[model samples]
Structure formats: structure tokens, C-alpha cells
Target: MDLLEEYRRATMFFESGDPGGAARLLEPIVAAEPENASVRQLLARAYFASAQLVRAEEQLRALLEIDPSDHYAHHVLGRTLERQGRPEEALGSLRIAAAMRPDNDDYRAALRRVEARTGGRPR
Candidate 1:
């Protein structure tokens, strides 16, 4: 299979609002290129957008293992946990993302919302 063309197809699917389709297309690409951060990140996002929180969390966590400095992975992991109703578990990742990208309003907002939810003091 032409992975690059497939990746483009997946990207188009994601952009067209068919996250599940994008995810299906991306799964094989990710399996073939486990270390491809861009592919993994997009797959993670597709899972998240499709409400597959567990899968999203797994992919996001793997992304972090590949690059712990990935603020977006941290943020999305926090979001996945939050969506799973595990606000307490979400706090650590949210905090890390917020700290890593202090200029990111979305990341800071996610942190604040989770902190408010869990009654945790801001970090």
C-alpha cells in the first residue's frame, strides 16, 4: 500500500469530519510506522474525535513515550482522561501541558477547568 497516499486520504477524511474513517485508514499506517510521530498524533486525534477515549489515551501515551515533551499529547491525554470521567487522573497531564506551553490559551483553559473540577490548586 502507498502509505503516503493513504496518509493523505486519511488527512482528507479527518478534514471532512469523518474521524472514524480517518482512524481506520490511519491504523495500518501507524502499525507500519510506529515511530512516526505525525501519523501517531493524527491517529490519536482521530480516535479522540470519534469518542474512542481508551484508544486515544493509548495512542497519546505512546506518543508521549516517543516524545515526552509533546505538549499536545499531554493535553489530549488529559482530555481523554477527563472524557472518561477521571478528572483526578487528568490533572497531571493537564498540568504538564500547561507548563510546557504557557502561552497556549487552550491548554491553560483545560488545566483551569480540570483544576476547578477536582478542586486542585493551580500548579
Candidate 2:
């Protein structure tokens, strides 16, 4: 199958609550295309679903290094940071994600949660 098809299959697995399966499918794709931000992002999502926070963070960080303006990477990193009890950092990343895609409710919600936890507005 093509890259997009493989990506779609991985996404379907993730949405179906089979993140381990998704991760298994995405591993080779990521290894084969290390520079593909989209594949890395999908692998990060799978890792997050499996509660592999460290791996997820690593993937997101790598994606950010490749493209700092990636909204999804910012969003995932924010979520991972929040889970790791770094509300301040989470807020910063979520705010960047919200700014990158103001219409995305997930980023906005994460930003709001971090704000509430920190008792401060976006910085």
C-alpha cells in the first residue's frame, strides 16, 4: 500500500482503540521515512494512546525540531507535558497550538485546562 493508505490504516487503528496495533503498523513507516513529520505525528499519537509518554514526547520533540510550527506536535506535546505535571510548559505549548490553529477546539480546551490549573491567562 501507499504511504497515505498506510497512514489511514494506522489512524483507523488508533481511532478504534487499538493503539498498539497502530504503533506496530507505523513503526516501519517511521523507520523508513524518518523525515516524514506526518508519520512521526501518527506514531506519537499511538504512543500516547499506549501511555508511552516518553516515546510520545520524543516523537513530538523530533517533529518540532523538524518544523517548529507544527500545530499537532504542539498540541500533543502540550498534552504530554500536562500529563507529566508541567502545567506551565503545557500552557505554553497549547497556546502555540491554539495560535497556529485557532479553530481547533482540542488545543483551545487544553489551553483552558492549563490556564485553569495555573490560575493565569495565556502567556
Candidate 3:
């Protein structure tokens, strides 16, 4: 099957609340396509959903290193940071995502929430 098909299967599993299955499905794809930002991002999402916060953070960090302009990576990184009780760091990452896609309400809302928690502007 094509990569897209595999990715879709993983996404379906993730959306169905089966993150472990999704991660299992995506892990090899992620390893094979280390530079595929979308796969990395999806794998990170699966990791997060599975409560593997550290792994999610690591994947998102790698994604950002590969493409600084990847708003999704910034957003996910912010989420992971927030979950880790680091609101300041979350704000910094969320702000990058928000700046990259100013029209996205989810990104804007996340940025605002992080800013409020950190008692500072979205960094």
C-alpha cells in the first residue's frame, strides 16, 4: 500500500481513540521517512494521544528543527509543553504557530491560554 494509505489508517486509528494502534502502525513509517514532516507530526500526535508526552515532545522538536515554519509542529510542541507544566515554554511555541497562521482560531486560542497562564504575552 501507499504511504498515504498507511497514514490514513493510522489517522483513523488515532481518531477512533486507539492511539497505541496508531503509533504501532506509524512507527516504522516514521523511521523510514525520518524527513517526512507530516508523518513525524502525525506520529507525534499519536504519541501525545497515547500519553507518551516525552516522545511527543521529542518528535515535535525534531520536526521544528527540520522545518522551523511548520506551524503544526509549533502548535504540538506548545501542547506538549503545556502538558508538562511549562506554560512559558508553551506560550513561546504556540506564539510561533499563531504567527505562522494568524487566521487559525485554535492556534490563537491556545496562544492566548498559554499567555494567560504564564502571565506574559504570547512569546
Candidate 4:
């Protein structure tokens, strides 16, 4: 199998709003190249868009392990936690993302919203 071709196809599916399809296509690619951050990140995004929050969180965490400086991974992890109804748990990641990229309105907004919802404390 041409992993690059498969990755491109998965990206197309993701961009076309077929996240579940993307996730399905990406699963094998991820398995074949477990250390590929780009493939894993796209898989994580597909999982998140498909509402497979747990899987998304897992992939995002792995990405973090690979590169702690990944602000986008932190942001996505925060969003995944928030979607899972764990606003308090989301705070740390959101804060990190916002701090790392203070210019990102979305990251800052997410951090602020979660802080407000959780009263700036974990539940």
C-alpha cells in the first residue's frame, strides 16, 4: 500500500467533511507508522471531528509525548477534554496552548471559557 497516497486520500476525506471515513483510512497508516507525527496528528483530528474523543485524546497525548512544544496538540487535547464534559480537566492543556501561542484567539478563548465554567478550579 502506498502510505503517502493513503494519507492524501485520508486528508481529502477529512477536508470533505467525512471525518469518520478519514479516521478509518488513517487507522492503518498510523499503525504502519506509529512514530509519524504528521500521520498521527491527522488521525487525531479525524477522531476528534468524528466525536471519538477518547481516541483523539489518546493520539493527542502521544503527540505531546513526542513533542511537548506542540501548541496545536495541546489545544486539540483541551478541546477534546471539553467535548467529553471534562472542562476542569481541559484547563491545563488549554492554558498551556494559550500560553504557548498567546496570539491565538481560539486558544485563549477556550482557556477563558473553561476557566469560567470550572470557576478556575477542577471539579
Candidate 5:
């Protein structure tokens, strides 16, 4: 299949609650287009959804290395870290995401949750 077709199928799988399938379809695309931030983001999301937190963290960190200002990457990485029982580490990433996109309620909520867990005031 073509890249677009594969991407579409992977998205469909992800949206249909089959994240493992999505990850399978996206892995090759990610390998083939290592610099494609969008693809990497989707693959990272797929990994996260599939409970592959380690891979998700790796991909998100790589994406952040490529684009430090990516609010979504920070937010997702925060959530991933939280899921891994690392709320303290999650706080910094969530805070950065919330600060970057102050209007985003989801980001704010995530930041607040992490802050509360770490005994920090939610600003």
C-alpha cells in the first residue's frame, strides 16, 4: 500500500480502538520517514494507546528534540510519564504544554492533576 493509504488505514484502526493495529501499520512509515513529525506524532499516540509507554516516551522525546515548542508532544509525554507512575517528571512537561497553550483546557487540566499530585499550586 501507498503511504497515504497506510496512514489512513492506521488512523482508522486507531479511531476504531485498535491501537495495536495502528501501531503495526504506522511503525514502517515512521521508520521510513523518521523526520516526519506528524507521522511520528501519530505513531507515538498509537504506541501510547496500545499501552506501549516506553515507546511512546521515546518517540515523544525524539519529537520534542526536533521541535521543542510542540505543545501536543509535551502534553502527551506528560500523560505517558504519568501513566508510568512518574508524576513528578510528568509535571514539567505538562507545565510546559499548559504554558505554551494556555487556552487549552485539556492541557490545563492535565497540568493541574499533576501539580496536585506533586503538591504544587495549579496556576
Candidate 6:
């Protein structure tokens, strides 16, 4: 299949709660298009949903390196870190995401949750 077709199928699989399938479809795409932020983000999300926290973290961190101002990358990285039991690391990313996009409820909520876990202190 073409890259676009594979991407569409992967997105369908992810939306249908079959993140493993999405990850399978997305892996090659990511390898082939490492600079494609959208594809990388989707792959990271797929990895995260499938409980592959390490892969998700790697992808998210790479995405952040490509675009440090990417709020979504920060948000996902924060969630991935939190899932990996690294609340202190997660708090920084979550706070950056929330501060970058104050109107994003999801980012704010994540920041709040992480803050609560870290003694409700703004670090």
C-alpha cells in the first residue's frame, strides 16, 4: 500500500481502539519519514495506547527535538513520562504544554494531575 493509504488505515485502527495494529502500520512509515511530525505523533500515540511507553517516549522526545514549541509533543511526552512513573520529569513537559497553550483543557488537566501528584507545587 501507499504511504497515504497506510497512514489512513493506521489512523482508522487507532480510532477504533486497535492501537497495536496502528503501531504495526505506522512503524515503517516512521522509519521512512522520520521528519514527518504528524506521522511521528500518530505513531507515538499508537505506542502509548498500546502500553509501549518506552517507544512512545522516544518518539515524543524526538518530536520535541524537531519542534520544541510543539505543545502536543510536550503533552504526550508528559503523559508518557507519567505512565513510566516519572512524575518529576512529566511535570516539566506538562507545564510547558499548558503554558504554551493555556486554552487546551487536556494539557491543563494533565498539568494539574501531575502537579497534584508532585505535592501541588509549581516547579
Best by TM-score: 4
- Model 2 clash pairs are none
Lowest-lDDT window of 10 residues in candidate 4? 114-123
Give candidate 5 misplaced runs (Cα > 4 Å): 121-123
lDDT by candidate, in order shown: 0.96, 0.89, 0.88, 0.96, 0.93, 0.93
Which candidate order results from sorting by TM-score in descending order? 4, 1, 5, 6, 3, 2
Model 4, span 1-123: residue lDDT tens: 999999999999999999999999999999999999999999999999999999999999999999999999999999999999999999999999999999999999999999999999965
- TM-scores vs. true structure, each candidate: 0.97, 0.84, 0.88, 0.97, 0.94, 0.94
Q: Model 3 Cα displacement at 44 (Å)?
A: 0.6
Q: Poorest 10 consecutive residues of model 3 by lDDT? A: 114-123
lDDT of 5 by residue, 1-123 (tens): 598899999999999999899999999998888899988999999999989999999999999999999999999999999999899899889999999999999999988888888897432
Once fitted onto the true fold, the runs of candidate 6 whose alpha carbons sit more than 4 angstroms away are: 120-123
Clashes of each: 0, 0, 0, 0, 0, 0
Off by over 4 Å in 3: 1-5, 121-123
lDDT of 4: 0.96
| Model 3 lDDT tens row, 38-63 | 88888999999888999999999999
CA shift of 7, model 2, Å? 4.4
Please estimate how well model 5 matches the true structure, expressed as its whole-model Cα lDDT. 0.93
- Candidate 1 wrong stretches, greater than 4 Å: 121-123
Query: How far off is residue 30 in model 4, in Å?
Result: 0.7
